[model samples]
Target: MARAPKTPPIPPDARAVLGRFETRGPVRSRPMFGGHGVWCDDRFVAIVFRGVLYLKVDGETRPLFEAAGCSPFRMSADRPSRLAFYTLPAGVNAGSDDLEPWLDRALDAAST
Candidate 1:
C-alpha cells in the first residue's frame, strides 16, 4: 500500500531559519517529514527537519559541521532516511548569530 501525501506548508520555525538565509533569489519552503527544505532559486540549500535546521554539507565543510557537534540529517517517519545535509549545532537558532558563517559556507558549497 502507498503512503499518504505530505502537505507542503512551511513551518514557522523553518520560516525563521530562512529569514536569515541571505539569498537574493526567490525563497521557497516545503514540508518534508515534519521538517522543511529551503530552496533559493533552484538550488537546494538548506533543510529544517525534526525541529532542527540543517545546512548543506560538502567535502571540506562536512568536517566543520561535525567538529561543531553536528550530525547528518536522518528521518524515519515512514522509513529510515538520511541526506547530505547536516544538522546545525543545537545552539544555533534562526537568529543565526554564530550560524551565519556556517550557513555562508553551506551556501558556497551548494553553489559549487
Candidate 2:
C-alpha cells in the first residue's frame, strides 16, 4: 500500500492573489499542488502556484493566452504534465483594474 501524498499548505501570497479577484464575488482559495486553487462564487477560476498566478483557459481562450505570451502550467520538470491554466502575464497590474479583463476571461472560462 502507498501513502497518500501530503497536501501542500496554501502559499502566503495566496491572500493577495485572492484579493485581486474580490470584486469578482465571493472569491476563495484552498491548498493544492504546493500552492492554492482560486475560486470565484464557488467556481474554480485560477491557481496560484510556486508564487505565480495562473488563470483557467479553454479552447477559445487558449490562443488568447498564447498570443499574450502566457505559458500553460506544468507540474514540474520531473513531472511534465501540462494543465489548461496559463500564467498571468507580467504586464498585468495587480494594484489597478488592469487585471479585470483577464479575470473576466478566466471567470468566463470557468463558467463553461
Candidate 3:
C-alpha cells in the first residue's frame, strides 16, 4: 500500500494567523493527500496544499468568498467537484489580515 503523503511545514504567515486562534487550542496537524489539515478542538478548519492555504467553510460563507472573488479548489478533472473549500487569492497569501475572517468562518463551521 502507498503511504499517505506528508504535509509541508506551516508557513510563517500562516503560523501567525493560527496564533490568533490560540485561545481555541494549539493547532493540530495531520497528513492528508500531500498536504496538511489544520484543526482546532479536533475539527478541521483549513488545509495547506502545495504551499497554498484553503479555508473550509460551508454555504453561509459563500458570499464572503464570492465578494472576495475567491475560487473553489478543483481537485481534478475527472472527480466530482467539492465546494466547501476556498483558495486564498494570489495577492492575499502572506498576511493574517485577509485570512482571519475566513478562519473565523471555518472555525465556526467546525465548532457547530
Candidate 4:
C-alpha cells in the first residue's frame, strides 16, 4: 500500500490570508502533489505550491479569477498538476490587497 504524503507547513503569508475567514481556524493541512491543501469543513479551499497560493472556487466563482487574468493550474511532467484549483498570478496571492477578494470567493463557495 502506498503511504499518504505529508503536508508542508503553512507559509506565514498564506496563513495570514486564510486567517480572515471565520471558518479558518479548523483548516486541515495535507500534502497534495508537491504542495499543501487547506481544508475547512472537509472541503478544500486553497493550496500553496511552489511558493504560490491558489484559491479553490467553483464554476460560479471562477469568473472572478478569469477577470484577474489568473489561469487554471495545469499539471505536466515538469510542473505539479493543479487538478481542481485555479492559481492567481504571481505576486497576487501574497498581497493582502489581492488576497481578500479571492479568499472571499473561496469563503462564499464554501458556504454554498
Clashing pairs in 4: 75-81
**What TM-scores do the predictions have?**
0.75, 0.80, 0.73, 0.67
Which segments of model 4 are wrong by more than 4 Å? 1-8, 22-25, 77-82, 89-98, 110-112
Best by TM-score: 2
lDDT of 4 by residue, 15-94 (tens): 77666654454767777777787787676788787656777877798887777778666545577653656776567644
Per residue, candidate 1 scores C-alpha lDDT tens digits across 66-106 of 99898787776565545678877878877757867876877
- After TM-score superposition, the amount by which residue 24's alpha carbon in candidate 3 deviates from its true location, in angstroms, is 2.7
RMSD of each: 3.3, 2.9, 2.9, 3.8
lDDT of all predictions, in order shown?
Answer: 0.75, 0.78, 0.70, 0.69
User: Top lDDT: which candidate number?
Assistant: 2
| Error of model 3, residue 64, in angstroms | 1.2
List pairs with backbone clashes in candidate 1.
Answer: none
What is the model-wide C-alpha lDDT for candidate 4? 0.69
By TM-score: ranked, best first:
2, 1, 3, 4
- Two-way TM-score contest, 2 vs 4, winner: 2
Off by over 4 Å in 2: 1-14
